[model samples]
Target: MVESSHHEKDEALAPAEMLALVRDQQRSVEGQIAAFVPLLLVAWGVAWLFGLGALWLIDGMRPGLTVPPAVAITIAAALFVGAIVLSAVLGARSGRGVRRDAATAFPAIVYGCTWSLGTVAIVAVGLGLLANGMDAALARIFFPTVLVLFAGLMFVLGAAIWRAVPMLLLGVWIVAVAVAAPFFGYPAVLLVLAVGGGLGFLALGALSFRHLSRLRRPLAGGRRG
Candidate 1:
């Protein structure tokens, strides 16, 4: 009877040990992820802001398109600050832990907003350049690039939908458009690709931010039942 009792004790210990091991692994991963995600968010935000800045500069240079540089800068800065302010004011997270999710989601929003803004700028420039009788080579560079960009965004957004099947299908569709666009002819092909891709990223960022917003509280801690 003593031997049987000893065997039961050993079995119980193995499970406890296993649980401890798993928890340790989880802690390590979560710490590393927490460190890296916030940095990525800031980088993405800066890049998006720069893209808009470039767009503003390009437009301001053209005659009919010209706007006050100070005005452009002010507007862009406002947008950037607005986003930061929104996070601070609107985030519902009840704990610091859930804030990590918001931080992670912020990059997605930045990336999406970046490309969407890029698309708008390109469209404006394209029109402005057409009106100004600019060189054909410039259009050759801008339009197709914008299309491919849009397509890429669409793919990202689709993935961000947080559904495996839909994201996978969206990935396929995005790839098909990207590959086929070059054949459609310059500018047109690029536009197709950019719009398709850009849409995905835009959608993804929105969904991710939405999800993070909903997660304003962390999971309750305790042993599972």
Candidate 2:
């Protein structure tokens, strides 16, 4: 009985077993940190889909077929604001109780602030140009395309930090759309944002969820075993 118990203990402490345990713990930590990612993606997807879609309907299509531009813009603004709020809340909640070294935390803090600061800078630049007599029609194309481009760059930065291939791909897609939007022109550009950017978010969110599910299954089996 003593030898049998010793053998079992040795098996548990073997290098392979130790490595597997560490891997499982790491996976668990990653899952917890990423739990809110899908929700954030979906929220943004909804915002882009309906908000930009509304603008496209009002400005891109026949004016008679949709609500006024004012109303459409208002709706879009509200949705974007809601998504921002949701992202902030979710991000904070995810970090609760998690400890990270300065190396890891610094990048995340800077990146988060970049989203806000970069947005303000872009808005200021856009408005400044408009005030300087950039044509109203041109302003319409300028704002959305530039903002989309900023978002794409941010995504690329985020992917670099996280080493996420999917995120990098998404960023590339957004950049492509932004670059192409100018050629599409005003209201038509809105159509591109609505269909391309909006749907991209939704699709990415779905894939994230699917990936998470697969991760969970193995963890669950391990726990059961």
Candidate 3:
């Protein structure tokens, strides 16, 4: 009789143990993301600000005073390359202890590839339209379109994977800014990317870091659950 009772008790505790394991796994994933948040934010913030500033300077404030095409190309290349390098370094460093199962790894790879390809495609399309001498009205829509597509994807992916409210909100904010950019015109679009978007990212990064800090203290005290 005692043996049977002990067997039942062990079975009951098995599920609870499983539940605790899952929660810990999720928390660990979140923590790793938090560690990398600051680096990613800083890299992107610098890229947007620097790239927009370069574009504005090259394009000039008044009409017909634009810098040479070579100068603009060089600036864009440098900013993007630097941002890419910084992000790679941060990812390698912060992801050290994070467990990567197929379930998590596959989604991350897909999201990253999609964004990289989508951004490149958008740039290519814009350049093609400009080269073909597309009308001013159509040309003006290009930047906004790129912003909407990029931000929309981010919002969807973040909502799906992390279910992070702040990330979702940031995506919404970016999309709204992009939609409003055309009304304010080109200079305003630059300001939106550099100042508005950068600030939003920085805020999200800070929030993530704070959340990780809070979780650490509690989890450190004892095994959660």
Candidate 4:
């Protein structure tokens, strides 16, 4: 009778124990995500390098070699579209569970949407100006507007949401560049957007990757040994 009573007690405790174990695992996953979320920086860096680098090269061509506007715009659009798609995919993969993953991805998705909508609005305004017989000189306003939007997005998402220092710094740098870009001319403006921003992203991406690797190495080593 004692043995049967003990068995009943064990069974009674089993579900509670199982619940505790699951909660622990979920916490562990959340902790990992909190630590490793910056790994997404590496992906973002690569995408920016490719997209902006291509656009810079195309736009930098001398008069004889200038790319047609349609071609340049098409290429830039495709590259940015690819980057957004990849970012979404990467964010989705990093997220572990439905609710948690959605929480993780929601800010980024919103950030992306903000950039997309802002860009469209800016472009529409530019088109309207052009249709109203504005001179081509007004086209220069586009980059400054874009840089402002980029800075705002970084501040809102990186500083406010993720609390990423590098991103906040980048926002400041972009604002400075945007302020000075008009006086410096197109080449300088494009150079800041492409080279300066690309290098900053690359550096942050490298640092984030190193941190993640360090975080993972012990676990990997333990598993291997």
Highest-TM-score candidate: 2
How would you encode candidate 4's per-residue C-alpha lDDT over 1-225 as one tens digit per residue?
999999999999999989866865655565466454564555555555555655655667776886666776676678667766766776666565535477877887887677768777877887897789977655764654465546545564667787877667767765665665566566455655655555666687777667667766655554466
Clashes of 3: 0
Better of 1 and 3 by lDDT: 3
- Model 4 TM-score on a 0 to 1 scale: 0.67
Best by lDDT: 2
lDDT (Cα, 0-100) at 95 in candidate 2:
81
* Weakest ten-residue segment in model 1 by summed lDDT: 216-225
* C-alpha lDDT of all candidate models, in order: 0.54, 0.89, 0.70, 0.64
Question: What is candidate 1's CA lDDT for residue 96?
Answer: 40
lDDT of 1 by residue, 82-196 (tens): 6565444433322244445776687667755776687787789788988899777567655655555464456556456544454555566556666675665543443454455
Q: What TM-score does candidate 3 reach?
A: 0.71
Q: Model 3 over residues 147-189: C-alpha lDDT tens digits?
A: 5548655875777797777778878877776666566666556
Q: What is the lDDT of candidate 3?
A: 0.70
Weakest ten-residue segment in model 4 by summed lDDT: 34-43
Summed backbone clashes in each candidate are 30, 0, 0, 0
**Positional deviation of residue 205's Cα in model 4 after best superposition, in angstroms:** 0.9
* Per-candidate TM-score against the hidden true structure: 0.34, 0.91, 0.71, 0.67
Query: CA lDDT of 133 in candidate 4?
Result: 90
- Indicate whether candidate 2 or candidate 3 has the larger lDDT: 2
Tens digits of lDDT, candidate 2, 90-114: 8888888788899998999999899
